[model samples]
Target: MNSIISEGVQVSVETFYQPDYSNPVQSEFMFAYRITLENHNAFPVKLHRRNWQIFDSNGSHREVEGEGVVGVQPTIQPGESYQYVSGCNLRTEMGKMKGTYQMENLNNKQMFTVDIPSFEMIVPMKNN
Candidate 1:
């Protein structure tokens, strides 16, 4: 839960999740996450795309590379935060996700990277 800015733009990430215990046969796993980005500089910033590496409980892995999140590239003004609710489905019971965001500062004409911290997706051992 830590973030920093190189030139004035800041990025922060938080991950949340919910499990489907009743419809196990559906082979569906649900996840939720919120991404917050703040522009500290005088320029505006844009989040262009995402690259994710998802790891399951069985030592298996999956890659999800996509353009933007939820089909829209977000632009944030200075002192403002861009937040979104996004998710995925897993065939397995538990896993974790981590990735990076490609962002650009419009006013500076510079591009920088943002790290999306890895978060857990699981059904607690006590419940299992």
Candidate 2:
């Protein structure tokens, strides 16, 4: 798991390699990641957008940017948290991902960016 705190928001990530969904012969690897966003500020926050940078060990790279996560913009209350699961496909056995979330302070309607700590996804056997 990887974690970071930015702008009073805590972002943590845990990655899982989905062997069942991966085709080693085809050079396709699938990974699922769970992200937890915790609001440490005194005010509530609403997730507005997300931007991701994905890299594969094969020298492949991509950027993903869009509104919300998993199709919904979540609102996290002060001292509360929101969790979501998302998937990514890589051309290699190892890869890393990092991103940022654009969030709005519900109390003041101010926008801020929170860093999502970098996390790695690797086929279990590849770790050795």
Candidate 3:
């Protein structure tokens, strides 16, 4: 797992290779990642948006920007955490992902960015 803290928010990520969902012969690889967002601030925070930079070992790169995550925006209270699982597909056996979350402080309505540490996804057999 990889974690990073910024603006009093902590982001942790764990990734899993999905063999059942991938077709290596066709150059399609699937990976699922679980993200946990922890609020270390004294007040609650709401996640508003997400931006991701995805890179593939085959030299493919893409950027994804969207509202919320996995569908709904969640508000995490102080000392609380919110978690979600999401999937990504790559044209290669290995890839990496990193992003940022836009969050709002519930107490002051101030917006801030929380960094999501870069995480790698590799096929189990490719680890060698």
Candidate 4:
């Protein structure tokens, strides 16, 4: 259970590798992930953008920045939890990613970051 606190919001992740759909010998891996964002603050907030630093097993690192995950910026109230499932592709069979969500506190004119905990992605060998 990897969780990080960003602007009072706790974000955690669980990754599932799709080895049946990957070609590890060719350095192609597929993984699906579920991220949970819990607003443990007393105020409400909305996720605006994504900023991440991803490091692959091959010593390659990439920075991905984007707005509105899955094309929607949903507002989550206080004590609420938001979850989304997404997928990503990597050139290696394993890697680690950590990032923060740019969030806006609707209650006040303040913007804060919600930390995303470092999570691992691994494509387990498919059993015959």
Ranking under lDDT, best-scoring first? 3, 2, 4, 1
Q: Write the per-residue lDDT of candidate 2 for residues 12-127, one digit (tens) a residue.
A: 99999998999999999999999999999999999999999999998889999999999999999999999999999999999999999999999989999999998999999989
Clashing pairs in 2: none
Per-residue lDDT tens digits for candidate 1, residues 1-128, read 54555456666656555654324577666666666777787778888988999997778899999889888999988888877777766666787788788889887778888777676666554236
TM-score of each: 0.78, 0.98, 0.99, 0.91
Candidates ranked, most accurate by TM-score first: 3, 2, 4, 1
Candidate 4 lDDT at 80 equals: 98
Summarize candidate 3's per-residue lDDT along 20-124 as a digit string, tens digits: 999999999999999999999999999999999999997889999999999999999999999999999999999999999999999999999999999999999
How much lDDT does each candidate structure score? 0.73, 0.95, 0.96, 0.85
lDDT of 4 by residue, 62-99 (tens): 99999977788979899999999887788987888888
TM-score between candidate 1 and the true structure = 0.78
RMSD of candidates 1 onward, in order = 2.9, 0.6, 0.5, 2.4
Clashing pairs in 3: none
**Ranking 2 against 4 by lDDT, winner:** 2
Name the candidate, 3 or 4, with the larger TM-score value.
Answer: 3
